[model samples]
Target chain A: MRKLPELNAAGNKIPNRQAICETLMEAAGRDRNVVALCSDSRGSASMTPFFEAFPEQSIEVGIAEQNLVGISAGLAKCGKKPYAFSPACFLSTRSYEQAKIDCAYSDTNVKLIGISGGVSYGALGMSHHSAQDIAAMSAIPNMRVYLPSDRHQTRKLIEALLEDEKCAYVRVGRNPVEDIYSEDDCPFEMDRATILADSEEYDAAIIACGEMVRPAVEAAKLLKNDGIRAAVVDMYCVKPIDREAVLTAARRAKLIVTAEEHAPFGGLGSMVSQIAAAECPRRVINLALPDAPVVTGNSREVFETYGLNAAGIAAAVRGAEEFL
Target chain B: MADHDRTDNVMKDHKMTNSELALLSCRLREQTVDVITGAKTGHIGGDMSVMDILVMLYFRHMNISPANMDDPDRDKFVLSKGHSVESYYTVLAEKGFFDFEAYKNSFSRYGSEFIGHPHNTIPGVEMNSGSLGHGLPVCVGMALAGKMDGAPYRVFTVMGDGELAEGSVWEGAMAAGHYHLDNLCAVVDRNGLQISGRTEDVMSHEPLADRFAAFGWHVIECDGHDMDSLDAAFREAEAFRGMPSVVIAHTVKGCGSSVMEDKAAWHHKVPNAEEAAQIRADLEERKEACRHA
Candidate 1:
C-alpha cells in the first residue's frame, strides 16, 4: 500500500480497463498459468497487447460471453487462473448463469472481468450499458465483486485477486477520468473501502465506487469550500462491502449520500442504506441512474443529467436540511 | 513403481472386457433404479438410457479414478445431462470414490452433499451441472487447457439429445471445433424424449449429426445400450485428432425394463413397489443373458 496523493492534485488519468489489461499481461508474462480470455472484446478491453505477447495464455472466444465464462471456469478447473474479459451488459446478464453455476457454485478460480461497466458505454445507449451488473454479480454466492475507482486501485485489486484461488468479478469503466490518486501515492487494501475525506465536523459522507469515486471526492471539496465538511469513500468492494467504513461514515456525518453509475435498486446506494438502516439509522440519499432508460449522450452528459457530478452531489448535500 | 504409477500401470495394464463392462452396467442400472425408486424423485429414464455409456467410459476407457484424482493428467468427465446424476452417483460409488451408503441414505436431503445436481464437492464429479448446455462449454475449456499444456488428458461429457436445443450448446459446439480440441469427446444420450414429450415435438434437434458437423465436430453414431458399440465409438473419438468428437448414442429411454421402456413419464416418475419388482426382474434377465452372451 502506498500513501494516497492530495485529493486536490489528482492528475494524469488512465482508464481502469487499460490498467487491468496491462497488469494481466505482466502477470501472464511471469506466470504461464495466468490466462486472458475474451468474447471478441480484446480491442475494447485494451488487452490486444497481452494477447500479442502471450498468445498461448490468451483465448479469443469470439463474441460468445456464455462460452467465455464456461471455458474460463473449465480452464480454472485444470489449475489455470483464467481472467474472462467481456463487455458488462452481455457478460453480466447473458453469461450470468455460467458465472453463477460454473464458476461460483462449482468453485472454479475464474476471474470475471466486466469491462465498460455501468453507463461507461454512454452513447451506445441502454442495450450496451450495464446499470444492474453490481447487483447481479453480488447476488451470486462465493462471487467477490469489485469496482476499482482508478488505474492504481485496479492494479492493486487485480494483483490481490491473482494471489487468491477464488471466483471474483471485476467491473471497470471504459474512459479515463482525471486521476483520483497520483501515480505515486494510492493506498490499497483488499476488500476495504478507501476513505478520501474525513473530518470530525463533517456534514455528510458521499460513498461511491468505480467511475463515481473521483466525483465524490470533488463533491467533498465543493462542500468544504462552502464552509461544510463532508467525508468521501471509495466503496470498491461491493459484495463483501466495508460495513465498518459505512458505519463510520454514518457516524461522521448526519446525511449519507451514496453515488454510483449503476441502477438504484441493487447497487451501492441500496447496500449503504441497508447497512445504515440496520446498524446505524441515518438519512441516505442514494444518487444513481434512474430505473427508466436514461438519456443517451457521453458519460459526462449522462452523469450530469442524473445528478451524479460534483455540483449535483454538492447541491444534494446542501439540500440535506430538508430531511433533517 | 510409486503407488500412482502402479495404479496408472494397473489402469492401462488391464482394461475390462466389453461383456464385463456390460454386466457392471446391468448391476448399476439396478442400483440406479433402486435409489430413484426409494427417493421417489429423479431423471430415471435418461439414467437408464445413459448407463452403459458411463459404464464403458469409467470401466473400460477414460483414465480417471479415485486413486489418480490428484493427477493433473488424468481425464476429466462431466455428466452434462446432469439430471442423470443418480446413475453417476452409483457409478462413482461403485468405482470406490466414496461410501455408497452415505449417498444412498441422504441424497437430495437438506445439507447433504449428494445434491440432486452433480457438484464437484463430491468425489469423481468434475463440474457442478444441472442446467443443460453448461457441461459441454466447460469440457471445451478443460480440453483446451490440456491442449494448451500439451497434457495427455481428455475431457468427456454426456448430454441428452434434448439439451442440444439450448443455443449455448451450439456456442460450445462452435468453440470445441474452432479450438480444434481433439482432447474433448461429447456423448449425447439420444433417448428421443425430454420431460414434455418426444424431443422433436418439443424442439427438433434432428439432423443433430449434421448440426454438430456444421459446427465442425466429427460426429459418430452408435447404439447406446451396447457396450462394444460405445467402446468402438469412444476409441474412434480418441484416435480422431485435430478436432472435437461427438458420439450420437441412440438409446432406449428405459433400457432394461418393460414397464418403463420408451416411457416419457418415467423421466421423473418414481416406480411403485410393483413397478420396481418388474424392473428389477427385467434387469436380472438382461444380466443373465449378458453374462452368457
Candidate 2:
C-alpha cells in the first residue's frame, strides 16, 4: 500500500458557512434581481452578511419554510433568481411538498441552499442532521444536487449557480473544512467530477461525494501502500452522476466502491450502483450511513464510530476485490 | 326631458350595464361546468364557487389583453386555489387566449398541457399551481416587483376559503401587508366546504374577513355569484392604496346546478349522463330567461 499523508494536520482556516454567505452576497451585489429568502435562519444559515450587504434583496419570511419556497418561486417567475436558504433538515422535510410543486414541477429558477447538511450539526442531535437531504432532493425531477467538498468548491458552486437557470439544491457544510482544491482552481463545471487521485492501472476505484471525498483520497493512498492501486473520483454532482467517468472507472478497474456521508438508499452510492448495473456491470460495494437514525457525537467521532472514515472506506474497497 | 338629456350625454360614454356582464358571467360558468362534466373529471365545486369572480375579473375589472399575454406591463392573476382551474381555463378560453377546443380535450391525452391545474404551458397562465396556499405569496412577489420597477401593472390572486387554514397563506398575508402592496388584490372563494366536509367542520376559517383585516388588508365582503357585487368589490380594491385588498366572496359550493348546489360531493364528482343532461337543460332555460328579461 502507498503511504498515506496526514489530512489537514494544520487544521481548516475558513468556515464553510461564512464562505457561502460571502459568495451569495457577492452575487447579490452584482445583480439587482438576485434575492435571498430564508425561513428565520439568517444567522444559522450564515446569511447575515447578505442581509446586511443587500438588505433590499433579503426577504425574511419568519419561520415559514413553505412560504419561503413559494415566494422564491414567485420571485423566480417574475424574472428574479432567488436563493431559498434554511436548515437542511426542515428545508428537505417540512416544505418538501412545496419544493416539489412550486419549484421543481413549476420549473422555477430557484436555488434551494440547505445549510449544515449531513451531520455537520453534530451534538445538536439527529434532528438537526440532514442525512436524508440528498435522498429527498434527488427524488424530485429537474433538480440538480451539489454537495461540494470544501469552502472553495462551495464558493465555486455558488458562482456556477448564478448562471445555471435550472432548479438546484446545494447542500452546504456548517463547520470549517479543509480546502480540497487550490485557489487557482476556483471554477468547476456542475456536471464534471474532480479526479483527486488516479493511476494508469488500478485494481479498484474509490468513488466518493461531499465530506467523504477527502476520506476517499486518503483511502486511495492507503490502498496503494498495500500494493493496491486505487483511483479516487469526487462525485460532487450527485443527481447527474458523471456517467462517462463512472463507466470508464468501472471498465478499467476490477471493483468500484462508492462512499458518502448520507443514507444508503437513493444517495450517491445507490446512484453509482444503478449506473454500474446498467452500463458497466461490475462488483460494486457501497459504504454509507445506515437507514436508521444516526447516533449523537462530534462530527469526526460519529463518522469514525460509524465506520465512515478513510479506514472504513479502504476496508470496503479491499473487501470488494474478493468478487473481482 | 332636458335634465335627462344632459345626464344621458354625460353617462353614455362611461355606462356599463350589469345585465350584459351578468349574462357573460352565466355563460362562463355554464361553459366551465360543461367542460368539466364532459371531461368526466375536475373540481366542479370550487369552479362553480369562483366562476363569478373569474368572470368579473376577466370581463370588467383587470386590464388584460388576450392577444398580448406576454406584455410586460399587463396586470397579473394567480389562481392560488388551483384545484378550481376549471373556472380559470374556461375564462381564458372565452377571452381568446387559446381555442376552446383545447379546453375540451384537457387532461385527456398524454403530454396534454391542460392538466387538472394551471400550468405555464397554457397561455396566460402566470404560474403553474395546483398545490393549495402557494398563490398568495407569489402574487406578493409580483406586486412587489411591479412597485419596485415603477410599473402600473396590478396583481390579483384567488384563494380558497379552506386554504386559509394553511400557515403559509397567513405568512404571505403578512408579507403583502408589510410590503404595502396597494396594487395587489386577493379574493377568497368562501364556499364553506372543502373535500372532506364543511370548511367549518373540517377546519374553521370563521370571521375570515376579520382575519384579512387583522392582517392589514382592506377587507371587502360580497356575494361571489353577483356580478354587481364582484365589480363593486374590485373597484374598492383598485381605489385602496398603501395596503393590499382581499374580497371575501361568499358563494355556494355548487352554484347554478340545482342538484349540485351547496353539495360537497360534487367537489370532484364526474356528472353522470342523466345529471349532465339536466344541467344542460337548466343552463338553456336560464339563457332564454335572460333574453326575455
Candidate 3:
C-alpha cells in the first residue's frame, strides 16, 4: 500500500468547490460537449470563473434547481456532458424527483454537483445545510452518491464524471479545507475507498468520508504518539461503498469509529456499521452531527462543538476502552 | 433500410386532405379504443382528444419514420401528456415504429414494457414521461443539444392543459423562452377536462395562449381535432424564429363518441361493455361518414 500524505504539515486550504470549477473548466475547454450549469449559484459554487471563461459552454438557469436538473438531463440525452451546479440543500430535495426520474431513471448522463453540502453554509441556518443529501441521493438506484475529501479528490471525481455517461450526485463543502493529499500525491480510484492509514494491528479503526477525513487523519496522528495504532479509511464513495475496506478495518481494530459531517442515520456511519456488523460484528462508534436543527455558528465551531474534529475523534477512540 | 418499404408509407408522396386524415384517425381510434378495453384500463378520454394532433404530426408533417430512427438529425417528439399514450401507441404502430399487433396483445399487461406511461426503451419513443410537467424541459434539452451540434433535428413535445398547474412546467417554459430555442416546439393538448374535473375548476390555466406567450413563446392556437388546422399551426410555429413556439390545440376531453365527449368522469374509467360497443360503433360510423364525404 502507498504511504499516506503528511497530514500534520499540509499545504494551503483550498475549497473543494473551486477545485470542481477549475477541473470542469479544463474538461469543457478541451471538449465543447462538456457543459456547466448553475441555478443562480455560480458565485457560491466558484463557477463564475468557468462561466466567464467559457460563455457558450456555461449555462445559467436563473434560480430554479428543478430546471437545472431537467435541462442537464436533456442536454445529456443529446450527447452533451452537463455538470449541474446548485446548492445541496435544494438540489437534493427540490429537484429530488427530477434527479430520480429525469436523470437516473431516464438514464441520462447528468452530473449533479451539489455545492455547500453538510452545513457548509453554517450560520446560514438549517435551511441552507444539506445534512440529508447523502441519504436522499444514495437512495436512488442508478444514482451514485459521492462526497470527496478535499480539493484533490474533488478534481479527480469531476474529471471522472465527465468521462462516463451516468447519473451522479457530488457534494462538496463551501469553505477551503486543509489539504489531505498534495497535487501529485493523490492516487485515485473511481468507487473504491482509499486508505490513508492502515496498521497490521490497531486498538481502533477510524473511518471517515468527505471533509471529516482530515480530522480523522489528525486523530490518527494524535493516537500514534500515544502508542495507540489506528487504521483510517476514507470511504468517499458513499453509495456502492467499499465494503472490503470496512470489513478489513473491522478485522484489524478492537473497535470502529466512523465520522462524517452528516446526520447519524443513513450517512457514512450507518453504511459502515451495516457492513461491519454483517461479517465482523464489531462495535461501531458513529461520530456525527446530532439529529436536530444545529445552533448558529461557523463550520469550524460547529464541528468542534459537535465533536467532529481531531480531538473529538481521538477521544472517541480512546473512550472505546469503556466498551472493551 | 428494408423497413423503408413499409406498407404505411402514406406520408412519402401522399398529401392527405384534412378529411382523409380525420377518417384515418377515426379508423386508428377504433383500434385504440379496443386496446384500452382489452387492457382493461387507460386514459381513454385524453387519448381521443389528442388523436387528431398525433395523426397529423406523424403522418403529414414531421420528418420521422422507422427508417430514420438511427438518424441523429431526425426530428424528435416527446409525449409530455404521456397519460394519453394509447393514442400515441396507435399512431406509432401505424407508422411501423413497432408491431401494432404485438403492442396490442401485451399493452399494460403483467411484465409488459408497454405500460400506461411512455417508456423510451421501446423504439421510436424519446423520453419516459408519465409524471406531469417533465417532457417539455427534456424537449428543451434535446433542442439545445441539436443547436449545439448544428443538427437539423426539430424537437417537439405535447403537454396536457391540466399539466400546466405543475410549477416545474413554468420553470421549463421560462427556460425555453430564455433560450430562444426556435428549433423547439411544444403543443398543449387543451382538452377541457382532467381526472378531478374541468381544468378551469381544478386549476385556472385560462388564457393558455397568453400564458405561453408571456413565457417568450410565440403562441399559436388551433383546432385540436382538425388535422388541417393542426398542420397549419405547426407550419406557423416552424416559420417563426428567435424564440420557441407553442401550439394551444383546442379539443374536447372525450372527442369521438357522444357517450364520452366533453365528460371529465371518463378521464380514466374503463368503458363498460355497452359503452365500449357504442364507442366502437360510433368510430366506425364516423369512418363510414368520412369515406362517403
Best by TM-score: 1
Better of 1 and 3 by DockQ: 1
Please give, for residues A1-324, the per-residue lDDT of candidate 3 as tens digits: 344567746555569999998898888888999998999999999998999999888888999988888889889988889999999999999999899889988899999999999988989999999999998999898999999998888888887888889989999999988888878888789998887665577778888999999899889889888878877888889987988888888887889999999988899999999988889999999999989998799999999999999999999988887643
lDDT: worst 10-residue window of model 1 chain A: A1-10
Clashing pairs in 3: none
lDDT of 1 at A297: 92
Pairs with backbone N, CA or C atoms under 3 Å apart (clashes), candidate 1: none
CAPRI-wise, candidate 3 is: medium
RMSD of 2: 4.6
| Fnat for candidate 1 (0 to 1) | 0.83
Residue-level lDDT of model 1, residues B1-293, one tens digit each, is 33345335545734778898899899999988878876778889999999999998888677788988999988899899999999999999998999887887788877889989898889999889999999999999999898888888878999999898898898999999998988899999999999998999999887999988999999999999988899899888987878899999999998999999998998888899999999999999999999898
Candidate with the larger lDDT of 2 and 3: 3
Position A257, candidate 3: lDDT: 96
Error in Å for residue B163 of model 1: 0.1
- Interface RMSD of predicted model 3: 1.0
Off by over 4 Å in 1: A1-13, A322-324, B1-14
Global local distance difference test of model 3:
0.87
